[model samples]
Target: MGYEWLALAAAFLWAISSLISVTPARHLGPFSYSRWRMGCTAVMLTIMALIVGGWGSVSTAHVMPMVLSGLIGIFIGDTALFACMNRMGPRQAGLLFSCHAVFSAILGYWLFNETWHLAEIIGATLVFSGVVTAIFFGRKGSDNNDWEALHGKLAIGVALGLLAALCQALGGIIAKPVMQTDINPIAASAIRMITAFAAHSLFWASGAKLAKSKNPINRKIFSITALNGFLAMAVGMTLILYALQDGNVGMVALLSSTTPIMVLPLLWFITKQRPNHYAWFGAILAVIGTGLIVS
Candidate 1:
């Protein structure tokens, strides 16, 4: 039961890492930023695996799904998300991103035949609803990119957002059977990171496309992206695997949906202003949901 708390912690860690990534993502562009971040994460995970000597757990059965998880989740899902963010803005894109929980829950049931208890069902619903509410009416962006701005760009963003959700959900589902086994979550994360980083590297090397913003990858950019990669990829992803290793994949996925809600305090601290009171209620709802999920 206590292990469920790790999922909550993962939500916070991801929120922090996402906040830290804005500067680098803007500086290097999302694709470049993610590429560098993946490399840093791979290095971090590799070092940890070496120290623990847990690389021996990976087998032929675990390899393909883990690699495919990396490809679908990190490579395809994240790339689509970045594009959605560019077109729809973070808040708008996030509103759609919240749907990952629904996709995760459905896929977990359909693919793995995973079922939830009554408490788990109630808990996940509340958390998912709360996050959606919080994101919809939470922080007002500076540029005021309304979710209702349904232009061509917005349409594309919506489509990409859904696609990202599906990819992410499927990725998590794919990883569940492997993670539920005796494999170390840290090692699992390392394998996935290596897979994702290698794939992105090949894509870049192929010159299939170039970033919209061809900003030079400066040293500072590298440092920040590396930091972000450590938090978001190394820590956050490890906790995700750890959660899924012992808990219901659907429940873990929904719990991880709290990242945006977790961002409220950080926003308040950074801006010297409070989040919308509406967000506080949403937070309360999510906490109650957490209780039910863990009960």
Candidate 2:
């Protein structure tokens, strides 16, 4: 399959993972879930690295950039995402997180001088506008102040999601320079994961007592976090890197940005919470935009 197709598949898997993660986030705090996700990803990637080449391909020059990318993308970006998910719910958080495409596109353009065609730009704009409309204006039978307060909270969540997106985009751009080196993608990813693990360890070490007191860990939370780590970080990110191997970074990011669209139907199926019509429209626009950009 083409990289675009692989990216789409990854997006679907990520969406499912996100939906599933929300369940655990409700019980275990976002930081707890993030710690589990990062830790598991580090372990899995380390095993893969050992089996593949034992870091023989990795160079000292590439190490720092990979570490920075991992810190920003996995440690910071993912933590912010989980926080937004907890505060804003899955739908709104997913929609806002979709802005990763825009941020990636901008960073790719600046970093690599990638340019977009008119059709691609128009398609992206349409998709983004549709998503914003759906998130802000598509509520049904809600005129209460509480509803307004929800919208306000969603706005803040969206802002944080955008910040995460920016970090992810910059991380990808920074990774590109490293990818151009002789380092293997798998090894590079492992290095990144190692750094992420270290950063997260520090975070947890400093906040362990507070986290334990605030949100006690339970069986269900651990199970969900483990599942999220496998699906979202390990499988999804591996597939993304594979896709990037065959395509432009911007196209890969755009295609992968459809994760929110994929999540909508899965949410409906799992939670029986169908997206509003506007959301459905936005999802369609996102798919179409991805096609235009990638093709």
Candidate 3:
């Protein structure tokens, strides 16, 4: 598959993994849950890298950038995202997370001299508009679903979500040059996971209150956390890195930002509640926009 398809695949995995992560993330708290996820994903990627002799592809030149990418992306971005999710639930959080596409596009233009065609720009706008429509107008006023519940200050949640988006964009941009090298994506992903895991380990060791778990760890929670790590970080992230190897950072980010659209159907299936017409309309817009982007 092309890089665009790879990015979309990553989006799909993230959509599934994000849904799986909600329960455990809420239980363990964002910081604790993020730490656990990084650790789990680190081990998984390290093993895969070793098994495939992918580590040999990594060079000293790639280390610093990958480390920076991990710290910015997984260490800060992911934790902020889950915290946003804790406050606003998946639907709203997903919309906010999708803002990374725009952030990445801007950053790519500024930092890497990347430019998108007019068609791509319009496509990106439509995708973003669809996200806004789906998130704001998709839910019914009468729907008192748990996913609709707001846990904390809406302002704080929105800030965190945007912060997550910016950091994620920065992370990808920082890694773009390294991805152009001969390094294996799996190896690059492993470095990122290990670096993030190490950062989380240090934070936990600092005995910060945020590092404490809100609920006791149970087998179910552990399983869910591990599964989320596998799909989201291990597989999903690897796919993104692979796409970044050849694709423009902005385009890859835009394609992957479709996670929100992908999540709607999964959300409907899990909640047994169909989305309103706005959701379908938004999905159509996003699909058409994606076609424009890749055409």
Candidate 4:
């Protein structure tokens, strides 16, 4: 029971990462930022894995699945999420990303032959309704803070956010079977981060237009980006996997999906303005919906 709290802690760290990432993600652009973040995280995980002898648990058979997971989850999912955050701000992006719980549940039902009762269906509905409500009515006209302002088209942000959520769902599905084995979660995470970093590096070397950074990385931005990587991927993700080792999957997902709600006060503290009623209501609705599904 106490171990389940790891999921909540992970959610809190992720909320903080969202705040820390805004500047770097905005400055470097999503693709470049993700590349740098993955590289930093890969190094950190690799060192940690070595220190703990976590690599002993890994096998050649686990490589491909981990690669796929990293490609879909870290490479695409993470980039899309930050891109969405760059446009819609962390509050909206976080809410949309929380839909990963719904996506994960649906995918689990389909792929694992897991049966869902009526509660899950209602939960899914509430999650969707919450997302819609928050996106449409989350902000007041008086909220003119840059963090609350939309950077680009709302439609693009919404699409990117949903894409990130779907990719996250797919990533988890791909990794679940492999994770049931005795492989070390730290080593597993290291492999995924390395795979993602390679993918990002390759993309950058190919000179893709979108891969270009909006501004050159400076010490300040690099430090913040590295810290974001450490918090979000190295620690935050590892915590979720650790919790999943002992906690119920549904319960873990339900707890972790509360990142949006957890970010509200952090947003208020930083921005010096409370989120509107719609924001609070929508976040609560989504969490409640997740509770019903996982309960």
List, in order, the clash count of every candidate structure: 0, 0, 0, 0
Local distance difference test, each candidate: 0.79, 0.72, 0.92, 0.83
Q: Which is superior by lDDT, 3 or 4?
A: 3
What ordering of candidates by TM-score runs from best to worst? 3, 1, 4, 2
- What is the RMSD of candidate 2? 3.2
**TM value for model 2:** 0.87
For all the candidates, what are their Cα RMSDs to the real structure?
A: 2.6, 3.2, 1.1, 2.8
Tens digits of per-residue lDDT, candidate 3, 155-176, equal: 9999999999999999999999
**Please, what is the TM-score per model?**
0.91, 0.87, 0.97, 0.89
Candidate 1 displacement at residue 293 in angstroms: 1.3
Better of 2 and 3 by lDDT: 3
lDDT of 1 by residue, 1-295 (tens): 4657888898888778766766677666667777888989999999998889878887888889899999998888877776676566555566677688889988878887889888888888889878877777765442332322333565787898888878878888889999988887888899899999898898788785553335888888888888878887899888888888887777887888888788778756765657677778888888899889877
Residue pairs clashing in model 1 are none
| Residue runs of model 3 more than 4 Å from their true location after superposition | none
lDDT of 4 by residue, 115-225 (tens): 546886687677667755665576675258787788878899999999998887777778777777888999999988999999999999999999999999999999999
lDDT leader: 3
Pairs of residues clashing in candidate 2: none
